[model samples]
Target: MTLTRRTLLLGLGAVTLSACADTAPVSSLATTGLPADLRPTPNAAYDAWVASFRSRAEGQGISQSTLNAAFRGTGYLPGVVRRDRNQTEFTRTLEDYLAITASDERISKGRAAFDRHRSTLNAVEARYGVPANIVTAIWGLESFYGERRGDVPVISATSTLAFDGRRGAFFERQLVEALRILQSGDVTPANMTGSWAGAMGHTQFIPTSYQTFAVDFTGDGRRDIWSDDPSDSLASTAAYLSRNGWQSGQSWGREAEDGALQPQPGGPRFAVTRNFRVIKTYNNSDSYAIGVGHLADRIAGGGPLRGSFPPDQFGLTKDDRIELQRRLTARGFDTGGADGVIGNNTRAAITAYQTNEGLAATGDPSPELLRRLGG
Candidate 1:
């Protein structure tokens, strides 16, 4: 989910269909020279749509002052429309998914973050039944532990998507909820930021989700998930799991000697429990749940999986892929740290090396390519 925001829907057991193939950061106009499409642009149709939406909002209990304040500097963002229209679903293998979600970097960072916020996480776990590591893993997955909480303005994003009419009804509801949040004064219009699709805060809660699950763990009056301190967001996640039936003192799942729950054909098998299903309420993907479970295990000083995946579609084993990456990097092409997962960076590096060797640049690894790279 690196390219796109994690699909953290509020629906407990309902499936979320939206997917994005790529999701680069949308720069803030205040912080950087905004891209033309990302910046707010004038649109007569959008203004007219907002004019119509105002009445419906007021009908739904949005005060006039709240509406006026919410949409003050908000307008159509063409980038939001582009993102909504361009989403395409692509599934990564469970092995690759784990590699990205629970990579060495993420594991190290999760441990550090856990240590730094041990007291807060423990308190949150004590209050809610969800364990601290599970909460920490969700934070790591949602926004890279808050490092990439996005910079898009919530009002502008949801409003633009609502007016676009692809999934207008859903986003319109989100826009209304965002306005209600503004009215509650948890955050201000200027400070209300999120992803292009309007997922917000440290845990990437959509507006409705935030309204339902966000908490004020700091004991302030507001459920402030947008603050630098991650207490509220973390507690909110724990609360969501606890409410959704997270069984205290149970494993989310585990890598078993053998089981029927292998996500990939020749990958490591898992024997999951009821708590694993509870983790799915957050993102609703087996790989995501497993990633969180496994990462939580790792953050608690557990080792990697005991079982192994056979090989990738390219007929390359994890060791072979890692060797290929090392060979490529040795020859002046960087594969972004020899992770066995073949991501965009590895593919780009392969393409560059193939081009240099005057071979067809399919960017797909093969035994021949590995041999050429001195594997």
Candidate 2:
């Protein structure tokens, strides 16, 4: 259940295999090695999947009409599983990931979204005791303020994942909950598109999360987190955090001033509160948690990073820095075998390179030094 790279890959593989299974004819089921680009259309695949779900949902107390209405014509979305599979590659570096998701463009857009939905956000804040900016920042980070709410069919994605048998039981529960969402009239399946992993809405609630925390802030008798009105989604996120122990007054963490402190030796210094650790439970990466926490702070009007980051040692790009470690190891420089992470061995390699070249020995990788290494 830990959200590691291996788990992510397993989830994606499930999605790729299962999304259109119900729609595919029994005759075609025997066909092996289908092209990656092949997919079931909304018309052909949607009803069959819905029919199978409807029977089970009705047995579980979901109304027949509700299931019928919700699941009509939903399709497997293009590029959703592919995108999920490639998420790590896209955000390979913390700096690059932050530059995109926490960029001026996203921040400015988030502020505008905040202003536009101030009333709802404020109401949720008042009710939940969670700040509006934190809620909005989660919204921005999860789905770009609902502008990119994903196009993958939640039922299809979850069902596919569940049947794939990798993490079958976990995803099976999520699949059931997704059907329940439809039966409850919260959202139509066609409109229930989300990440390939089945996380949905502005705040990216998976089906189990939706069952636990989704709210009905609009008072329409439905926990409509997927709609254009962000009230429910925002409220749901606040509820989630509150239930998981989000502190009202504490900060997540702050950037350390010291560049000499490597994550390998001392790890990134973080003055983390209990709530900050709770945020990491959402996605178990320190860099991801830091990015969300920092972005949340910026959205709440905090200033830029207060520390100086030492330039990468060796004349190396981020990728080059990692590659240099690999090349150095090949040349018996013992740069600690490339891990795409800079550490003591890589630092020592840079120091040795500097010593040999009669350059200032800072033990950091710089672009100039990388060129000398033919990087």
Candidate 3:
């Protein structure tokens, strides 16, 4: 299963990561829930589990008052189970990946977010030693600049996952942390919402991650990642990166400018610096970090990639795609506009041409095929 890391911190998918090498311990349970202890874990029922958990919380030094409010009206959500079970593996080419993650629209939006919060970002940079653009790139990827932080109630989701017992131990801990967050009064249970796996806030930090890395950057005493202001979330994200050892002047590799654009696994990766490695700590996927880096570069007005990706499973470059499209169009095949993005129409045209040429009609594009087409 793919790990669901909170983007503000590396989505560990319940995987534990300490930006500071250790999650900070909550010293006092917030003074919010029930005044006295609640009864046992509910019998085989999700409600029962929560009840038992409330008692457990009381044992953990949480007050009855905190448990009462935190668990009230909370119940299991089956959708969280479904989401937890599903994880799509990486299959897209780097070009295709960038096309989606760092699309023109996202780049434009990221640039504006960078511009809109220039002073805050600058302060974060000065203090944390992480580049402002890198942090902003992560923001764009995680919640689309806070446009879509998941809407699931964190308590309900964590309790459900905990009760479900698949990753029971992990979820149970998160459930406790969610309660602590409430007890501390950083936010109400209503506002303690996040992804099904419980990654919350602007940067998708899971509950444990929040305790570990979240900071009250607004100086409001609460690290408010969910509020509309986003000062805390933005600052908190920077703090996470900084703690992960983000080198002050490092670049997260780049598209290989070296002519051979083998697109399948992506052209070539620069041997990745310490900062680049730290980016991996967040998502642990090369493509993911690459996407963040490229997108950040684009948002900063950096030029389009100098090298078009090399031959994918289908062979070679933007020019090749357009030329192939043009050639096929000339030969009575409608390959659509010479747009470098080769979707089905282009594939079908190639298949048809191959069949007429007495060749194997695999339908995949190749440089050799382009040469034969005089493209």
Candidate 2 ranges beyond 4 A from true positions: 1-38, 41-59, 62-93, 256-268, 313-375
Report the C-alpha lDDT of model 2 over 1-375, residue by residue, as the tens digit.
275211343232212223223333412322123234324334334345445655665777767555444334333434443544456443234544555567777778887888898898888888887788878887887778888775556765665555444566776677677777777778765567666677777777788778888888889999987778888889988888788788887767676744332333323444666666767666666666766777777777776555423334333444666677776676667886654456677778878867877989888765655666773
Predicted candidate 1: what Cα RMSD to the true structure? 5.9
Model 3 residue 6 CA deviation (Å) reads 4.1
Tell me each candidate's RMSD, in Å, in order: 5.9, 9.4, 9.7
Model 3 C-alpha RMSD vs. true structure (Å) is 9.7
**lDDT tens readout by residue for model 1, 182-262:** 999999876788777888888888888788888888988999988899999999999888888899989898899766699
lDDT of 1 at 280: 81
Return whichever of 1 and 2 wins on lDDT.
Answer: 1
Q: Pick the candidate with the highest TM-score.
A: 1
**Residues 307-354, candidate 3, lDDT per residue (tens digit)?**
545665565776677788898889887887666667778889888999
* Candidate 1 TM-score, true structure as reference: 0.91
Which ten contiguous residues of candidate 2 have the minimum total lDDT?
10-19
TM-score winner, 1 or 3: 1
Which regions of candidate 1 deviate over 4 angstroms? 1-34
Ranking by lDDT: 1, 3, 2
Model 3 residue 105 CA deviation (Å) reads 0.4
